[model samples]
Target: MKSFEYLRPETLDEALAALSDPDAASLGGGTNLLDLMKLGVAGPERIVDLARLPGLDRIETLPDGMTRVGALVRNSDLAADPGFAAAFPMVAEALLSGASAQLRNAATVGGNLMQATRCAYFQDPFAACNRRAAGSGCDALGGANRGHAVLGWSPACIAVHPSDFCVPLAALGAEAEIAGPSGTRLVPLAEFHLLPGEEPHRATALEPGEIVLALRLPAAAAGFAGNARYLKLRERTSYAFAVVSAAAALRIEDGTVAAARLALGGVAARPWRCSEAEEALAGKPATAESFAAAASIALSNAAPSGANGYKIVLAERLLARTMAAAAAGTPAEMPALPGSLMDDTGEAAHA
Candidate 1:
């Protein structure tokens, strides 16, 4: 086991200062970081604990109707917020769909954003994982590649990011408040995460020592409110990671879709929203046939890895369902594929 220095700074500035160490990593909730540390996947020389830092645990709503979520706020609290759920049901459902209740209670918003990929090869240091160790090559590309990415994947790495919240955030056009060495900056949530190309090690656009202060969810524009849903397809019913998930919001006036937002998870290196899909839905009827057509257009460019071609079909089906459910104010239905796609274990069936 590797040894490391643990620093618990009381103030935000102190915590940010401690994170300036080149080999340091920030710890919030430690649900994800501690596990990686135990597995030797994360070997930080210093851990800057941000759990006790002040001014980052509140969920405040402003006069402009925008909501500011502190990075340290627990997932459970965020999901349980009455105003948040009423205004952004899709985002609330996305948060609730992640992990078990116990784990969600302990995990922070920022920690979830920084959670590493759950690729089998990335978890095992002995395996050839380009994300874990640069230039090591990726074993998932040709072996046990069923759970790998179907979109935004490169030859260097096929791992998909694991985040349910990111899907809704991306679709909602949220922004992140980053505190860095120079000063503070607000970055759109869509641009916060990076797609793994040759540099899979760099999971996020977060610069070294740049601390995430908060996540700001802008108020939905007029006519774009309430009609939204988050649908996650896992190997099992609950408490499992998504094999495919969709976050969808639509404004249907006179039975026609005025505007739409659709973002996908578990299919790409980062949560992805297709402009083509949104465009296809615009000025179209909000019917099942229309939804299916838009979904097909959304994944028109999808290039699935071997064994994961099922994801393309599955994503389209789920996308259509999510759109219908959101329009009806109902939750999405589950497991649209054959029984062979998922078993009792809620894990990918590896060969």
Candidate 2:
């Protein structure tokens, strides 16, 4: 591992001060940072550990019926939290479908939100990746890119976002609480993550020294009574990355879909919300036909790679299955696909 300085600050101000340095980086749970460091992908001169920062680990229900989830909240804890499971089952279910229990214990909410993409070109050192080196041509354009992206992709990058949590967060309309030199601010979860249009290296909107403080959900999102489901299609049943996954929360009133929130993962550079699909389902009866139509609307403009040409069909089927299960209050069987391993090590470093 590369040598670096470490500072464990007990206060947010100290942590921000350390992170303000050009050579310094912030550490939340170390799940992503440490992995990148070991892979020679991230070499920072200093690290500002936010573990000791106070008021960043509290999970409380606001008086307005919104939930304030601390940045330091463990993924396992958040998944198993009674309040989260009840009020936002989609969030809890999404967390449960990610890495195993042991890894979840070590992962934090903030780190998960800040986690990078899983593109092989971005992780492998020998590959020429535009995301790794701004001017380098993206090798994935002609390389093994079955799991890259199908939506919101530019010539600069086709890397797929890998956070399972964000899929649900996007569908649930969650907001973020951030702190920086400018003081505390709130960012909509949908807008928090940026797509790789021209700058593939710039992943998020977090400015320098800005740290995630908490995740806040809107009060209107609660009480959706209908079934909420998270469908993950991977190469394996456990410990695998999603090839195409869908998180859906459907609210059926009098046998008709009153509202729905659908978000897709492993298909775009960022968590993708299917507003067209949502619009198609609104005010319509929840049925196999409607679900298929919605899924079709969602994948209408999907652009897949050479090898991943099947992803479009797979995504549609998975989405259809998710909506069908949500309508029936049953869980869909996870589909078996190739090369969907939990190991994201093949991705290249800065090209």
Backbone N/Cα/C clashes per model: 0, 6
lDDT of each: 0.82, 0.81
Q: State TM-scores per candidate.
A: 0.92, 0.92
TM-score of 1: 0.92
lDDT of 2 by residue, 1-351 (tens): 889999999888888888999878888889888988888777899988889989878889889888899999999999778767777776777787788788899899999988888787888767887777787879999789888888888888888889888987888888989999999999888778888898988888898779899999987677553477677788777777789888778888898999998888889877888888999899998887888899999999998754687888988888877776567652222213111223211221000
Candidate number of the best lDDT: 1
Candidate 2 structure, TM-score to reference: 0.92
In model 1, pairs of residues that clash are: none
Question: Which clashing pairs does model 2 show?
Answer: 122-348, 123-347, 123-348, 123-349, 124-347, 124-348
Residues 167-278 of candidate 1: C-alpha lDDT, one tens digit per residue: 9888878888899888899988877888878898888889988988899888763235557778889988778889999988999899899999888999988888766898
